[model samples]
Target chain A: MNAYWQCLRGIVLREWLRFVLQRTRFLSALVRPLLWLVVFAAGFRAALGISVIEPYDTYIPYEVYIIPGLACMILLFNGMQGSLAMVYDREMGSMRVLLTSPLPRTFLLCSKLLATALISLLQVYGFLAIAWVYGVQPPAMGLLLALPALLLVALMLSALGLLLSNGIRQLENFAGVMNFVIFPLFFLSSALYPLWKMRDASQWLYWLCAVNPFTHAVELVRFALYERLAGLALAICLGLTVLFTLLAVLTFNPQHAALRKPG
Target chain B: MNALTVQDLSFAYGPCQALCEVGFSLAPGRFAALLGPNGAGKSTLIALLTRLYHLQRGEIHVGGHSLRDAPRAALKQLGVVFQQSTLDLELSVEQNLRYHAALHGLSRRHTDLRVEAELARQGLSERRREKVRALNGGHRRRVEIARALLHEPRLLLLDEASVGLDPASRLGLNQHVRQLCREHDLSVLWTTHLLDEVHADDALMILHQGRLVASGQVDALVQEHDGDLGRLFAGLTRPTATGAPA
Candidate 1:
């Protein structure tokens, strides 16, 4: 309906306006991955082997090999940080304003999640543009094909962020999540190294990486950027995105949650 | 039908009861005030009325639409201004209003017109382009009031809206809201703990320890209970040494 469209447009516009005002967030997001790409990757090139995985026919250098993971890192950080802001919004009373809307709660939350995801795409593209200039270019057609994959990963991560934030009712409790959630999801996945390397390091570690949803997100982006489809990765990302979103919506109950904590 | 109706509403925070069998109604175009002490569950009632808290046991009807059975319709007929500022400080005054209008699903042209009309009505047309952070406490509250009126709901609820304002600003806000009620035929439920905020002719409900102890015309209730508001409020809300309500 036209109403839904207008609501979504408004939500996205608010996010875009906020993003513009806090341009430092964009720069902060870019700095971490760029350090990994331009500095860490350069230093570790001799240490890590570059192999031609499935969906790849030509040899890709270490710089190109890790591009998908770093792009997803931006999404990961943005998604978690976005949900953190939601918790802070609750304290500041903006979340109450959003909930008081005439629209269904599910619809409002979804619009917000999608809007955050869409705004994050700008940062992803910014990183990709820098990579393009740094000599990590994929095929032009492949670049076009990777757009939807990047968006899907962004949505999946954002949903996961929301779901995780449900258990964290207090703002002070969120710093622990950065260490307990972000570091595990980032380091245990195929972001820095492929799964085969993890398998070579340890079978149990390889299974851990294989099952992490972030691994599927990264693999899907990696394959899409090479004009190939990872059907299994596609299925896992889609399934997890739906699961995380449903769980997030179901658990986001501020009123029922108690304000007190036991000593 | 009354502009708003709440019947036998009860709620709890875990094992602690926040509201118990509370009930009230506001007639069309009447300005009603909800007065309660800090721990008297005013926030709980506001949360329930605004749907920030789900209904645990009671029924609320707004403009003839049931909040339980037809939430969207019920909510469409109501407007609210929370105690804390909900306007995005980084956004312009007009931008905040437009965001609220869009959330209510107004068309772009309709939103523009409504925004313009509300600014003029609040005498804030000159400050539309300024960021909310630039506005002083009173002007920011005016902007919030204008934003709440954008969709033209039949009932307006202000939950301790005059908190953190100068005494003069508080009086000005109260008078301005009364003028708005006259001009728009809008029913208002103003919740506060301040005794000076309630005029003699206003409809008054005094809540105490999770229960409403008195409700009626302010003058009549004051005459019936005690000679003065300070003594009457102290007698009603004071807890006994045994931790029981007076």
Candidate 2:
């Protein structure tokens, strides 16, 4: 309906405005991946030569191989940060205004997830634009094809973030959890090294990387960026997006966050 | 028809009961004040009424729609201003109002019209483009009021809306809301701990220890307990000789 469209527009517009106003957030989002591409990848290029994979047509340097993973890294961090803001909103009273809407709670939450995903996409592109100038270019059409793949990963991660935030009692405790989640998700996956590389390191470590949803998310982007279809990865990302979003909606208890602790 | 109704509503946080057997109703276009001291379960009752917490034991109807069975319809007819300010401080007044209107599913034209009308009604038209952070506490509260009314719900529920205001600002805000009730025929249930905010002619309800201790017209309840409002409140809500809530 027109009403839902208007609501979606308003939510997205608010996020866009906030994103524009907070210059530091955008810069910080860029800094993390840029460091990996410019510094980490440069340092490791001689040590890790990437073979031609299913998505890559030829041998590539470490920087080119990690570009897709780093793009997803932006989504991963932004997604969790978006949920952190949700916790902050609940504490600060703005969430009460949001929850009182006449729309179904499920719809409101979905709109929020989609809006945050949309914003994450913008940040991903910003990182990609900088990477483009740094000689990490993919095929022009492949960049366009990667749009939906990136969006799906964004939604999946943001939904996971929201679900995680539901159980977090306070903002002070969030940084510890973030480091716990982000490091393992980034390091254990194919972000820095391929699954085969992990297999050479340890079988259990390789299995962990194989099963990580973040790994599939990275592969989804990696394949799409080369104009290849990652059917299995696409299915897994879609399934987890639905599953996490449902759980997030079901477990969301605004009262628990909004109530004052008894003194 | 009553604009709002609650029957035997009860809620608990784990083992601790926050509200019990709470019941009340408000006729359309009337102003009723809910008064209670701190720790007296006012916030809990508001949370239940606003559907922030699920109904654990009983029923609530807003504008003839049951909250449990038909929440969307019920919520559509109800507006709430929570104890904490819910405005987005980084947003301009107009932007905040527009977001609320959109959440209520208003068309752009309708949102513009209602935004204009409510801004004028709250005397906030000149400050429409000002960021909420720039406004004083009193003005921010008015912006929330305007936002709550944009959808034109029949019932307006405010929980401790006058807290932290200057004495003059509090009085002015209270009077402004009362004027809204009279002019717009809107039903209002305002919660506050301040006794002076309740007029003798207005409907009054006192809550204590998660129970509704007394409820009726203010002057009548005062006369029934004693001639003094303060004594009546103290006697009803204070601990008894046996260490139970009076």
Candidate 3:
């Protein structure tokens, strides 16, 4: 019990230290979403009219409306980037240090997932902090309320990212896969445009947005940031997080033949 | 009791067999050297021993715990230094050791004491705060050794751990590990293709193409195979599929 706690603490601490050491990662993480908030949102502010949504009491600016989605975007990119690092670790032999732990592989992998998720959350909050100064303030209480919701989405995306990266045979292909997964998950979901806008664009596209777990993740954060509850979104995020974690743990073995993670 | 044991062990990567019917045991305090050429499945065997790859057939027991049936317990009693360096170059030596200790579930007090002790033992206490990337290859390997020993496993396995070291560093590392084995009563299975690393009295196992071709005391095997270590190794591990011409 105490061992589990220590292990988790250590894993998180290592990740935090690494995150600190790599200043460029944090900077890029912020720069991506802030680009959307400052530039993309300004460009779309007049073009896309956001109606009264459940979390928003009145009409909201594009910048205000897309904050949750962009927050989730940070998670999405971090999740994939974390997976790429996992593959890199495997090849470079650092992963041997991890798998050799006497702890159950499942527990170790989860510790890693939680560690990456926490680090991603730091970047998300950083983005939110900048957004607050950018005149896109939610309630102070709502900001506090969004932490747990954002954490769930982070875990879900990290787990899903790990599961997806397991199939990647070469590290060189990681960028391609990242662009492939990130673009679809970002654009097809309610991250940029609202679901109503998607429906207006195409019925099938709207269905894809509705069913995409990222949409529910975005909605969950969107609601939590306003001190409300999206029950269905919460349920979906919780369920998918568990599912992705289990699937990731199950398929986590190093492939003996291809050494998918290594050369 | 034997510190480590394997029986009828076999593994395959698709159609290519990595190990076959290979069985051996390490006595509680002996230093055993495993010799194999590049294509000789040494890495595969090490991967299986460290639980990096799942077993397709056979059994492995580490300090009486079956690796397949009880991996956690089995791993708890085993420590390994892989062929490739596993330390995070970005982390300080002390930080790397702490991470390993935590993975093994050591308490804070235990971790501090163990880290200090192992670093001192490895002559690395002064470099605890130095990032691993700043250290030379030999020093980094020592850090890995200290980390591997922190949990105090009964057996230590090194898979070609001295690959890139200079001749002096390689011999120094080898001698250091032997001294550690004697002082600590820890069993070791050191794998390498270098014949000079094998002492006449140490337990020796030469693997060839997934098979244990010869295993016994090096002196006795030397006596049996015409008193020449090089010829014995070459004769036994000829590239032919049949092996040894026996």
Candidate 4:
């Protein structure tokens, strides 16, 4: 167990170092969320009316409403970005160094997921600090409780990214998956607008948002930030994380020649 | 026990077979050469041995552990220097070595001492603080070799690690690797297409079209074909009067 922790610590430290060195990446991760919160939310503030939701006893501003979503957005993007790096590393042959360690491949992949999740957590916290500076802050205690929620969401998203990294052979295919999967997953979620707003737009879209695992991930963070436990959100996020992580492991198994072989 | 054994190794990428019934073995202090042309499955075989790709119909044992059921154990005794560089250019030499040591679960104090010893042994002691990007090709390859040995693995695999180096550097690196095998009693499987890279006394395996066309000591194998390894290699790898280059 000590050795395992040491390995995990090294992996996480390497990831943190990598995150710090890549200035453009860290800044861009922050920039995208700020755009959604400051620009998109500003534009849609008057357009979408807020109602009393379960966590909300009174009306909330559009900026406050999208804070969790922005945080989720950072995690979602960083998770995929981390997976993208994994695919690039595999192509470049660095991943072989990581995978060929004597440790179980599952544990190695888990370490990568955890490392990515921790970085995503950092970016989320950075986004939250910026959001606070912009005058939209969660309850101080709620912010503390939200750490676990952020971790859960980060795990789910990173697992999804890992699944994609194992599934896609080439980096070129990643763009298509991002456009087809990530964008739709984000827009269909209640990240930017409320489900009620989507309901008015179309019942089908509202249903899609409700079913989207990303929606649950964002809602999981949002509810936790209000010092509330979202049972449904927790269930879906945990379930998807386990399912995706298992799929990633299966895809990465050495015997899975079909998956590893170049197309 | 033999340090490494590969029996009837076969693997394919979809419809195209990359390795077909290839077999070889290396005793505990032997240096073996896997010579093949591009697309002759040398890389594929290395991949299989390193557990990057699994065998479809074959067996590979490192030390005594089978790659299939006991990969973790098998891999623990194996180290590889791949064709492409794997060093993190952002890291210093010591940092890179320490990171790999940690991955193998070495204690911090021991890892630090071992890293220093390895660096000194590899002649990189003075450059330990230099970032990987600051090092030249030969120095970088040395760093990789040093890192691979950090765990004191019994078997070492080198896949075209000397490519793109000056002739002097290439020969120097090869000599260093060969000396390491002799001094440390380490088994080595070095894959290269360069005919000159194979020593006359080294065991040689020729791979062509994903099959082992020949295998034996270099002198004997070449002696069978009129003491000409280059002609024999060319004959094995060249397209047979084809319409165009394969």
Question: Candidate 2's residue-wise lDDT over A1-263, tens digit each?
Answer: 98788888888888887888789999999999999999999999999888987788799989989999999999999889988998888788787777888788888889999999999999999988999999999998989999999999999999999998898888887897677998899999998898998999999999999999999999999999999999999999999999999999999886765665420
> Which digits, one per residue and each the tens of the lDDT, describe model 3 over residues A27-144?
9999999999999999998899999978788998899999999999999999999888888887787877888888887898899999999999999999999999999999999999
- Kindly report which residue stretches of model 3 are placed more than 4 angstroms away from their true locations once superposed: A256-263, B241-246
Q: Assess chain B of each prediction and give its TM-score.
A: 0.98, 0.98, 0.97, 0.96
Model 3 chain A weakest 10-residue run by lDDT: A254-263
Stretches of candidate 2 exceeding 4 Å from the true structure? A260-263, B241-243
lDDT of 1 at A199: 92
Scanning candidate 2 chain B in windows of ten residues, the lowest lDDT window is B236-245
What are the runs in model 1 whose C-alpha is more than 4 Å off? A256-263, B242-244
Candidate 3 residue A262 C-alpha distance from true site, Å: 11
Q: B1-246, model 2: which lDDT tens digit per residue?
A: 799999998888889877889898899999999988888889888877778778899899999999999998999999888888989888899999999998988999999999999999999999999999999999999999999999999999999999999999999999999999999999999999888898888888888878899989989998997777788888888966763468
lDDT of 4 by residue, B13-67 (tens): 7788777788878889999999888878887888888887866898999999999
* Cα shift from native, residue A217, model 4 (Å): 1.2
DockQ of 4: 0.50
> DockQ rank, highest first?
3, 2, 1, 4
Q: Please state the error at residue B172 of candidate 3 in Å.
A: 0.6
The DockQ of each candidate is 0.58, 0.60, 0.63, 0.50
Clashes of each: 0, 0, 0, 0
* Global lDDT of model 2: 0.90
For candidate 1, give the lDDT of residue A84: 89
Candidate 3, residue B198: how far the Cα is off, in Å: 0.9
lDDT of 3 at B245: 26
